[model samples]
Target chain A: MQMDKNSYKKYADARAKKSPCAKNCVCAFLFGGLICAIAQGLKELYMTFLKEDDAGTLVSVTLIFIAALLTGVGIFDRIAKHAGAGTLVPITGFSNAVASSALDAKGEGFVLGVGAKIFTIAGPVILYGITAGAIYGVIYYIVTLIMK
Target chain B: MENLIRIPKPVYILSSASVVGQHEKNGPLGEYFDIVGDKDDTFGCDTWEKSESEMQRLALSRALNYACMKDTDLEAILAGDLLNQCAGSSYGLVSFETPFLGLFGACSTAAEALLLSSLLCSSHMTRCAAVSSSHNASAERQFRYPLEYGGQRAPTAQWTVTGSAAFISTSCKDDFAQAAHNGEPVPVITEAVIGKSIDAGITDANNMGAAMAPAAADTLLRYFRESGMQPSDFDIIMTGDLGFEGSSILCDLTATEGLDISAVHCDGGLIIYNRETQDKHAGGSGCGCSAVVLAAQALRGIRTGQIANMLFIGTGALMNPTAIQQGASIPGIAHLIRITADIV
Candidate 1:
């Protein structure tokens, strides 16, 4: 059916009225800042709970790994729904994915099943990092050696 | 907040069509190429003319072709275009027996169609709805052309091609659900962040990337905050074409924001017409660029479980003579759609 211009404008206006918030605003900044704060809190908790000398340094890294793991298991996603990226952006999200995948396979047998499966999701991340690092390392070493 | 609403169902982008490269190959629109100076020998006529009725016929036919719909099915069309009165869409939709709705968002028209169609299906307003957009080369020519008949064109401005795209959204039935082995549908649109691209203080066509980049970054960052999701939560985060310049600028801006979500994002415009094959100076634009990619590639991947969850972002440059005359900057807008696979 042909919609008259007035009706069309009404629809367009209605659609615009229903659109999401303008991107630049105090709320966006405050909320986004809040997510960052929670992530920092998680890092501090990991450091104190682990009680390692390098705890502070390791906490952020560990949390990211844990978060990625939970993402794999599908549980970090639930946490994310509640905390937003405040929970997911940290290292714990990665760990959740690894742990979930391993747990899923625990019934099969520990050594071959659970132990081997932990890396299913984490493996790619590790592989890419190591490979990229190695390539960069080699390039650096070559440049240094040539200068010498 | 009362005005802003969200759709609860996944709307599949079934098919998209583009006349960008097609115009260069052969068409009545080919004659206009002489004015633009076939510099790279790869110019696609972005502008063309067809009677309002003719445009409607071609657009509807393209939409139907992609939908794979039969004459007897109970479906409806949600279509839009840039022309005054939306003649292209109205005429095209008239031929169909199905109910139809006409809409306009200037350049943001297609996403509006998709959003409205998804809402209709989620609320059970209809079982299936089709959304499409079209831009005629000749019609755009008359709009931009001078009264003197011939005018020198800026190298950076893109030609608008006539094209149409459509998708079918069907209800999730019990039997289909059982057979598919799906999860609770990922929220199709938990949140959306819309941004208007204010003229980033530039008018040169080469700087469109800069003009549209802020809008892209603004919507994406907002979506992340409101939805409480990290970049990694999504298997892929796709943006409608911003061309090469805009894509890089967007990436750079996101990085500067400390968001660090770059590993999984891509622009639809950069991928649509392979630069190697078509050798487009920048990349495809117009409504069909994103529509086609979502239907043919992104949605297919999601349905097959290739990606668990995806975020599709469509961007548009809000350019009008009034704004330009007022010396106001061009503003841009972006809308995000999140789609997840449901087996059942």
Candidate 2:
């Protein structure tokens, strides 16, 4: 039987299993919150030994290191599978994306493989992040100048 | 005149072998596979691509061994994989002395290869081997992401199966026909129907089942129309790499076509993994997913006198990273082959 694209999609959508958004959101909230709570605890502990700025920087470093290492050992993706946006919303996801790409490309060689592909997953985020920030900066600049 | 090309003579499945990785080995059809890979899923190769090639080699070698034939016995070998330039098949079959033909049917390579092999056997060649494979790590690196990438898999996303299988087909001339004459059941290829590529405006690469289901439905409808066969004529209708999502979509799509195939539909993707246990969200995919399942499960059933007749519909989504990025929707194809134990 012949079908237009719209009808085909309708048929597919009717049969295809829908992702449980409520369950996924709940899982993401709990896991993402837990990650933040850990970061908060780590910052408090680091604050005891160093300056506040240094401690904050160290927290970021620590999280990135743990995420990258966990990715290398192949534990991060497993958790991310269940955590969904929870693991991804945090700084850990960025590190996992980079580290995973680097590891994946190590076979082809350092230059073409690792260097070129290191940012493959995270490239869009960086590109859009910077572009959006610059646009927001122009808006802020124009508003502040008028205020002055 | 109908898309049906009835084989002038039967090309029976002589032997086949399956080799799989840790994930597949851990699944329900674990023991059915001929060979299982190492703990690292490397299959004794240093790289994922090489491991994939090695799987093809091992499976073909084992398949030939089971038939008590050498590489020299094959008139030609047809191999295909889901890699750029079909690297796995080209490199995998290099050592064999037989003439080689490389194919690229995405997940449908197994069936495509079989179609060619059957044609060759029915025409001139006495024996031909069809090898199809796919590796999860290699497929991931090429198509989606790194092996360790912490990206959450979509509910519609299918897990590329790490497996390979070789099917050896021989014309029913002398020795091959002996089993049938001796009153024993033999898996025989009766007819084949090549399908047209169909696009359903699906853009998500993860939901390949949706993209390919329409093509499968189109092919099934055409096969039914041309051959004058109903869904119940066959004991089962086996499909390649539709997984859970594709299988359901296929049923619904065909249902709309006024063909009720739900009662007899079995998909390679769904049978390979347990939904409750394996996190293969939708199910297993790739050329190997269907190839190995057909080699290990379906063939075994036919040999054991369980299945009388069956139809294999190899479904494939012909999309690449470049086209997907260029805003091109995935086009799909499904090739149909009728295999039967009953010569009548």
Candidate 3:
């Protein structure tokens, strides 16, 4: 029953067969690109009826709303299963997180359940994001004052 | 070396029940489950934690019902879950009014509970119930990522089962008393091999199958050697929630020991889900993964005379996030229990 370290390592290596990462990567890239293309198309359609800044904000809002709705209906999870990181790494992913937590905590009532648990995933993103932005603004002000 | 402990008296498994979530309900062994729930009705509770607790309660209640026993008749309930401080099981069984023993063996809680309950029954103790459960959302939020995050999962990552299983184990007195009325084959707990914690220096948190594979192989080898039994002795040898990768490693490691179990070897993780279709990366891995499969599928297989004997090796990765983040190697354990249809 005694196995040498070399043979054990070899056995471990044999067990750790690589999964189909290349195929997944290609699928992710293609699907991710397609999502961006659709977003751009939406932006273009909105630009014709609205100003540039309004269209930009509206496009993001539209995408997030769509993702949240999809998550609420349980479609986003199905998409995420096959889409992999393509569905993730986007604003849609953020909306899906918020929507899913809200749905999961819905039975606990709005105050303690949905109110507290809704931010379970997105809380860190907002906290660190604002903190980093404020810190950068302070550094920029200091550098400008020194240059002047 | 003296790992195998033979039961002095017969410990009969009277009845069992499995309650699974939506995904598991759609799996291959879906028909075997006692109760299947939808995604929204996951245990019909408020929170995922509460949902998991409800799963355990329902499973235990159903199992006892199958045995036609009430909570007052049981000596103690041995149960556990893949949650912080075993909260799922404790909260679930608190209302049952039965004495409880909460165990923590990670994914191997099923076999651990069974082994302990069987030992108690074999020693002339009153009948005991063994239960274990895991919720996908609850386990995911605690261990990896929350559902909403849509975090990119690695292929090594396994889906935690949202299910629970319970079994009623009694002494020969109760077994014979029941057999006079019931015509089902009595599945007896014959022997057990308690495993030692084996560390293979595996650190990846996602790749738990590999982390626990070495422990399973070690336990199986020791069980065969100590009990003086060979691979062909049992109809089937089952590993608890090892998934695909771990099962392969188990096969390779046991092969090196000159024991070929390829023909009869099976893994609960692998059998619980369809690896190709279900997005369950490697397969299912949780306390409920093996527990539900064993309670529903394997136990039924034993009862119907499809399988005469089986060895269930419950494997677990005994590493918390703190241990992993602090660079501690993931240690694994596997406990073995032999269940047979034939009377001893």
Q: State the displacement of the C-alpha of residue B293, model 3, in Å, after optimal TM-score superposition.
A: 1.9
Residue B113, candidate 1: Cα error in Å is 1.4
Instruction: Mark the 10 consecutive residues where model 2 chain B has the least summed lDDT.
Output: B175-184
For candidate 2, lDDT tens digit of each residue in B1-344?
Answer: 57887888889888889999999998999999999999998988888999999999999999988877889988999999999999998888899999999999999999998988999999988899999999999999999988888777778999999999999999855555432234457688889889788888998888999999988988898889889999999899999989888898889778877999999999999999988998899999999999999999998888888998999998899988999999898999999899998432
Docking quality level of the chain pair in candidate 2: medium
Per-residue C-alpha lDDT of model 1 across residues B1-344, encoded as one tens digit per residue: 32234565544433333323354333322332211113322232232223333444454455445445542453567776666677667765676778777876544566666666777666765445444444434333324421111122222344343445556555444323322224433223333444544445544333344456667777777766666678998888887767776776677667777676678987766665555555354565666556655655676566566877887777766666556667665666676667765544
List where candidate 3 sits over 4 angstroms from the true fold: A1-19, A98-148, B38-41, B179-181
Instruction: State the TM-score for model 3.
Output: 0.88
Which candidate model has the greater lDDT, 1 or 2? 2
Q: Pick the lDDT winner.
A: 2
Each model's DockQ?
A: 0.01, 0.72, 0.34
Better of 1 and 2 by TM-score: 2
State how far residue A49 of model 1 sits from its true place (Å): 99
lDDT for each candidate structure = 0.54, 0.90, 0.85
Worst 10 residues of 2 chain A by lDDT: A8-17
